[model samples]
Target: MIQPLDSVIVHTLTRVITPVIQLFALYVLIHGHDSPGGGFQAGTLFAASVILPIIAFGIQGSLSVLERRAIILGGIGILLFAGIGLLPLILGGEFLNYGKLPIPGMEASARRHWGILGIEIGVTITVAATAVSIYYSLRERGEGEEK
Candidate 1:
């Protein structure tokens, strides 16, 4: 159990800055396919946003907000990535050949763009959830316990 800090400055700053960080993370995730930032960077930003509160308010409190949701998100991410990858194979194309994705009215190039975006989204969610899960596991260990 993380002991909640009593400092007003820390709590106030965390509350104020967390949302901004999350918004920036979303921006990074969205523009990643075209720009420099991508799933891994955005996911790290998002994980850090969640962790800011955990650090200021304590793990037990943050757990209620993120624990189950994180697990579910991780599962969703994996399923999405696998489903997208397999869709191409099922359609008689190689795995991850997004040109064969069944998006009605989309040109092959467009479908490829959308498919890459989907993959990036899946990666972002998986990375963020994994980071949060790792943080929780590490923080929840018993005092004096070694792993």
Candidate 2:
């Protein structure tokens, strides 16, 4: 596990800011279709929030929370995206044809909008989970210790 930093201020700030970063990430994800930020950017932000704590407090704490669930989260993301895409096909439309997403009572354009939002959500989850998983895999096994 990586060693925690000794600076109390950094640790304290990390604790305070992580949630804010995560909330911003969600905002970015939600507004992506209408603006510049989207799933990848938001996902990076989310991952950075988790990574900040790891950098400040070490992998020990983050690992306990992320270790087993990261892959599951990734899978959930994939399934959500694929399910939404395939659903259009099952409803007699082309793959990823968001207008056919079968969300009853919505007009085609609204269905399309909601479908795209769901896709963005899936992408956000997948990218964030993948980033954290990669960070864990690439982190130093142990720091400042004899082999």
Candidate 3:
């Protein structure tokens, strides 16, 4: 069992800062196409956002929100990436050849742009879920050893 903190200041600060962290993470993910921030950076930020509650409220509290979804999230992310790549192949183009994508209103450049965005979204999901899974697994192992 985890003990609740007695510090009001810490709790309040954590609550306030966590949302800001998440917002910044989203900004990084969205603006990555035009800037330095991208899937890896944004994903790390997202994982940090999830982890902040663990620092404040312990693993139990964090797990209550993250649950057992980390692996599922990671798998879904990989599938999305692979599926997008394979879509071009299924459309009679080389794998990941976004130029041949069948969007009706988009030029080849726009198709490639959308394809890159899809890949970035996949990478973001995979990285964040993998980071959270590692954290949760390590914490669980540490708790077992402590007992």
Specify the highest-TM-score model's number. Answer: 2
Off by over 4 Å in 1: 142-147
- Write one digit per residue (lDDT tens) for candidate 3, span 94-135: 998988877889899999988888888888999999998888
Candidate 2 to truth, TM: 0.90
- Model 3 regions more than 4 Å off: 1-5, 65-67
- Report the C-alpha lDDT of model 2 over 1-147, residue by residue, as the tens digit: 455898989988998999999999999999998888988999889999988888888766576567546878988999999999999999899999999998899999999999999998999999999888877666644443434
Pairing residues by index, what is the TM-score of model 1? Answer: 0.88
Per-residue lDDT, model 3, residue 111, is 94
**Clash pairs (backbone) in predicted model 1:** none
What is the C-alpha local distance difference test score of candidate 3?
Answer: 0.84
Computed on alpha carbons, the lDDT of every model, listed in order, comes to: 0.85, 0.86, 0.84
Pairs of residues at least 3 apart in sequence or in different chains that clash in candidate 3: none
